[model samples]
Target: MRITTETVAAAMKSALPNKTKYHFDDDLAGFGFYRTTTGTGTFFAEFRTVAGGSKKRLKLGRVGTLKANEAREAARKAIANAALGKDLAKSRAEGRAAATVARLLELYNERTRDKRKASTADGYDLIAKVNIVPHIGATKAAAVTRQEVQRMHGKVGKARGHYAANRAVAVLKAAYAWGGKHGHVPEGFNPASGVDRYREEPRERFLTDAEMIAIGDAMTEAETIGLAVDAGTAKHAPVGQRVVMSPYATAAVRLIMLTGARLREILHLRWDEVDLERGILRLPDSKTGKKLVYLPTAAIDIIKGLTPIGAFVIAGESAGTKREKPRADLKKPWAAILKRAGVSGIRIHDLRHTFASIGVGDQMGLPVIGALLGHSNAATTKRYAHAADEVQRRAVEAIGGKIAAALGGVK
Candidate 1:
């Protein structure tokens, strides 16, 4: 029957609840309506590929959504294109194969697993998970534009911070570069390119002597009370009760303050990494790569006091268990310590700065302090130069005052 408005209306009204049926147009080939047993009708185009290949069907719209004439015109164009050697089905499949941001991130992680450290890889994964993926993970890699990248960068900067924004953009840049190199993204298509990055000032916060003493007192009090008790333990109270910091955590904090090592460096410190006889810590890997941290007597004593619970000098709660893993973070205990000490606006990393500050105040040479702190180069250690200058200025003022007193008595 001819596929006119009347014919389609009749098919819709009389369609049976048995099986699907097709009503092709009498004037146009391959244009029709598929009537389902539920009385629903849809327009579709049926065409062959390469004149002798398999038939392909493309759904256009529902009967009410598309008129018979419009469906016929669309089907005619589709059939004509099919006859001209285009494979509409294959093209659809290729469109589905186009790379998305999520897919590109997965590929980037896999490719850089060996090239990046576990900590570095974790940072990248965090940037993708917490920042980039939530914003545009579903967007096609090839379709991402510089405008979208800039907007994301700006929004992240406003919401998080400028430094975090810069890091997030760096992650995006690396992902796009990796994708483009591997042909996952189009050549010369880097959305992150030319997007301005936020300028970040170096943030250096050192603990004052009073703040340091207060924190030490807090840690001591914490140790006496014990850190939070383990859950499901009848021997102790429930979680959230003030308990001592695990001996490991207590000793770890002391060492960081005494030695100026990074938090992760101390948390991940293994028994094999310590050299007690030489008073040195031979770090096999660090932010600046391999380094040797020269430990003073105080630092060495702190390390000696710690009783190794597992392979790690600072063991987590899983110590001595089959599922034991080294302490990966110190967020909870550190937060509690900070609260109890009444200390604000100081971070765990600030302990390192405090150590450098004290060294400079004691008239320790910058080069010597740099070596003790395991600085990779002089430039990285230059931040402490002002502390040394302050010390020298005080010495000169004392000497000049005595000389001036003697000249006044002679006059």
Candidate 2:
């Protein structure tokens, strides 16, 4: 008999205490009313998503909550979807799994963690926590629009500066691309694409000879006499009348100035990577892949002075643990040293630029400077060409002066 209100009510009344009863609609193949032995009646739909596939039973509300006609329409839609080879239950489950953008980001980070470098993974996590998630995390992953992403980019650019905003968008783009490819969101969907990036001016600031002298003096003071602060008298206190700095951090800075190596390269340096006899570092991996850094005598001396702690040359706090890690950063020690030196607007990275600029000012050829800096591309070293031109102009001016004086004497 057709599962109408009358049939469902009759089935519920006739449902034996020891047995269950079911009534199917005459016109609809899979729509039915089910009565349990406890006399509770519910509407249900049963169908196979594919031919010969296992049948799926979907509960369509209780008898009184949903009239028979209402349940029949729902069953018809579900049956039609099943005929199109769509698994409604599975689709609903997947939608719930990545319902929100925050959930999607969490899945993206967890899945892609092993594929990225530790530093890169950490940067992505920071971008999500500090930038991306806070803005659009509550939005549905499937419903995020290009307009929303563009708006987010604009806000970040205004608040955090262009470079930081650009980095955050880059991570967002990667996350969306990964989600689309992996079926978390709709395939070929990416809201982060085509968002205009803010224009960024590259930093050209480098230290002069006087500034270098000041920094050197500061380093000496930190290692020996200790820099004076306004707070307490503790040896390692950040706020203290006199704070003696970490020897490892001081050495790391000295190595950066002398060797022109990147910050991470020095911080993550292992003892096995050092070749003191040859005065070179055999870095297994760097930003530019495997790198070979030739060390001067001064850099070698700094390395020799350091006491080895476990695997890393510049020892982090977890140096002796089973999972030994490199020094997380050089921010604190660099700040103290800069304050003591009375230097402003000088970043740690500027030390690398200073090394290259000095070489160029001394008339070292661009190719030689490039090689010393481990630059794979000659074009990257071209920024120092102006310094070389200045050196040439000075040489010509001196030559002209001497020539004019000799000519006057002869006359």
Give all candidates' CA lDDT scores. Answer: 0.82, 0.85
Model 1 has how many clashing residue pairs? Answer: 4
lDDT of 1 by residue, 187-225 (tens): 457889899998888878888888888888888887887
Off by over 4 Å in 1: 1-97, 158-160, 226-240, 318-324, 409-411
| Cα lDDT for residue 11, candidate 1 | 75
* Total backbone collisions for each predicted model: 4, 2
Instruction: Give all TM-scores, in the order shown.
Output: 0.70, 0.72
For model 1, the run of ten residues with the poorest summed lDDT: 227-236
